[model samples]
Target: MKPKCGIVYNGHLQSDKFMVQLHWLSDTAKRHGFEPELIGNHRLIPAVIDGRCTLLGPYADYRPDFFFFWDKDIRLARHLEKMGFRLFNSASSIEICDDKSRTYEVLAEHGVTMPKTVTGPLLYEGFELEDVSSVPSIVAELGLPLVLKEAYGSFGEQVYLIASEEELIGRLKSLGAKPYVLQELVASSYGRDVRINVVGGEAAAAMLRRSETDFRANVTAGGRMFPYEPTDEEKAFAVRCAELVGADFAGVDLLFGPDGEPVLCEINSNAHFKNIFDCTGVDLAEAMFRYIRSVLYAADGSRKGDAPC
Candidate 1:
């Protein structure tokens, strides 16, 4: 019997990009002899009671052997896990990657090389910064023209470049008590960065994102993508970064250091692959499915061993 799997996506997000991802993943699953069902989070309700998960609605009794978690709905992912559905990236991995501050804490503990970052204090409602005096000292430590990023954001949407003490303070005040990160801006990597797709503990494809107009090199921010050949050291660094985060597949962004060495920028567990596909013509869904089969069905629809790579 062909193994059945579910490709979980954010159903409420009605976008072509989301549909494109589903199409690619479902097509790949079909080619690999697996029955792929598109599970939209909006239509499906995961009812939990006393540490038990029950499915309600169209998939009331249907259960898949595995799940390809392509959404950021962490609670739903966890609920599925509790119901014995194995998630590719896992719920814990998604949670960590969803928050930049937590991502930094995890990677730093593993000694991953990255820019110096300071996690900001969380601001609650009806509260303000009690000590505004430390703002200058933080600027002094990270220097001028630092990068400010919200802990929870995607597609470089909530990132800012603060050039002066006044600008930094102003932006900080505007941000209020939201969790953020202040980091040293790597001058060499301005308007440029490398994104490597790592799957099954190896680097598969890489693309260089460059933008002359915006400091952020995200393609969504009007950046251009060019095929990149990563050095062995650079590839190793990216692979290690993904492994540390326990991501079965990830898009790891690496920034160029002052001496041209690679430093970790960020890791995306549910990375959008449309740009990488257009640039490299490498179908990420195919690679992901291959990895899933090797790990989940190497022996009779159950993981063969502890070997994740």
Candidate 2:
């Protein structure tokens, strides 16, 4: 019998690309000799009952050998781990990648080449900074114009360009204690960046994103995409980032430095692959399914003989 993979995804996410990717993932699992089931996050309610932990709700009688976690429900992911189920892009890695501050904190210690950054203070109801209006040391270090990104946001909606001290204060006041980061704007990569999809510790595919009217070059934000060929240095850097994050597969964004060197932007644990597939004609889903199969079998062979996941 083939192993079962519960592809857990967010049902509330309503998007064409989201649905398409899920379909592709399911199809690829079948092609790779696995039984795939689409399990929404709502179905897997983590709970403890009768002195034991278990998944309840509409999960039915379907038990998975391992899970392909596509949702960002960290608690549920951890619960699944407690049950000894193997998950691609493990829960801790997802948590770090989900929050910008955590991602920077983990990578910064390793001397990754990224923008100069400062994580925002903890949020409280009446918290206020003393010198946001004076270009204080924080602003002084990051400069007059910098990038203020909310720690938790996607699709470039919460990222802002603070061009003046007043704008910084006003934006902070509006933010009202939400966690954020202050980063020195890498002017050289304005409205442009590269997205490299790394699978099984290799750069599988890449694309260049550019925008004519917006500083943020996200495809959902109206950016144009073109096939990109990363240099050997760029490919190696991206693979290193994915390994550092402990992701089986990930999308690594790179910003161009002043001298055109690649700078680490951020890592996406659950990066949307449809855009990359469309631009590069490379199917990350296929690569990912195949890669995980090998990993699961290799472990089984080395440990308990003939076991399957």
Give me the candidate number with maximum TM-score: 1
Best by lDDT: 1
Off by over 4 Å in 1: 299-309
lDDT of 2 by residue, 1-309 (tens): 887899999979868878989999999999987899998888888888797768777883557878999989999899888877888879998998999999999887786899999887776778766545434778889986899999988877799999987888888878887899989999999999999999999999999999999888899898999999999999999999998888999999999999989999889999999988889899999999978887777645342344443
For 1-309, candidate 1 gives per-residue lDDT tens digits of 777888888888878887877898999999988999998886668996676689888897877778889999999889888787789889999999999998999988776889999999877977876667888889888998899999988998999999887887788888887889999999999999999999999899999999999989999998999999999999999999888889999999999999999998999999988889999998898999988888766655664666331
| Worst window of 10 by summed lDDT in candidate 1 | 300-309
Score candidate 2 by lDDT: 0.87
Give the TM-score of each candidate: 0.94, 0.93
* Runs of candidate 2 exceeding 4 Å displacement: 125-135, 298-309
Q: What lDDT score is found at residue 299 in candidate 2?
A: 44
